[model samples]
Target: MLDQKFATLPKLILQIVQMLQNQSPSDSLNEIIRLVARKFVGLGVLEVADELEIQEAILRLEKEIIDLEATINSASDIKLAYAHNSKLEASGKIVFTGQGAYMCQVSAGGDVLAEKKDSIFRGGRLIVTGNAVLNELGSPMATPTMVEFVFGRRILVNRVYPGVSFRVGRQLFKVQEGLQDVRVAVDEQGILRVDYLYKEHLQ
Candidate 1:
């Protein structure tokens, strides 16, 4: 009976508790301690005295596991935030547009505009065009003269008529008669700066 109880106790605590179902409650604690001492020969009779300490250690380990899981979740959230910031930093395109604003298609230097499909401008000589126009009595009077932008150097166009212009550094030079504005160089630091041209009409 002692060997059987010791074997059952080593298998599972639930098995030991089931085995004690037939025993009186008053003798169950002593029987459990004997079985535990027999299973762990080095612990001897001290198993009964150390039961509360063992339970405390188990509780501590469970709390530590829960804390470790929470820490892992926090690290995952930080990684996700970093990834989102990286995506935002990599994106180099106009996100918002007003009533009379336009973001033109981007192409590589010396590439044909007809082949350009992606609108996100990155660097090098980029062709920017306006799609906003003013109509007078069902007739298109004039399109947007200048395109105010924010990137790299401060570029300002005085009178931007229908023409293709090239921007080198902070200077804007007319190139051809078309609907494209070209940016010559890319910013080195990747820090975005504003370049705006405001024209006020006085009556």
Candidate 2:
């Protein structure tokens, strides 16, 4: 019975061959021929499907590989260092804070530096030279929020909102809308100067 059913396959093949011969040269015509050949000649359906599935799997895997590479490139390294190191003893302002109980690691650029754990923090200030990031050693529950605090000489101003008034020290300053440029500076005394840290230091 199966043989009889398949006996007409030759006729079908002949029809397909004729169709291929008369077909116009187009992208779709080539795909139709491939489909007809695979279906009519008892061609390996499993192999064809497997090849397609493998191709799809390979594409997905390649996408995943690319995503992983991007993540690695953007990831930060956690290293351990001392707060009293000469490298951090320059003249800059600390812009972050962490819970003192846990070991703190500073993330500068892409490298991580582990610093000693301290509980008693006199103030949330790390005066050093250049732009650097400092954090608690452990994976803390929250990202360190940059708050306006008195370090030594320099003043840090964050949370700049448009159409709002800011209270720094004892005076209040009103901010105007559509302000494109902002300048911060420090004077001989503890005052907010007009300047900006446009670029980061290369460390």
TM agreement with the true structure for every prediction: 0.20, 0.24
Question: What is the clash count of model 2?
Answer: 17
How many steric overlaps are in each model, in order? 0, 17
Query: Candidate 1, residues 102-181: lDDT per residue as tens digits?
Result: 22333211111111122222212233322111111000123322222333433322222333344433645442332223
Candidate 2 lDDT, 78-113, residue by residue in tens:
322223212322122222223332222222332121
Worst 10 residues of 2 by lDDT: 136-145
lDDT of 1 at 5: 33
Best by the lDDT measure: 2
Candidate 1 matches the true fold with a TM-score of 0.20
In terms of TM-score, the best-performing candidate is 2
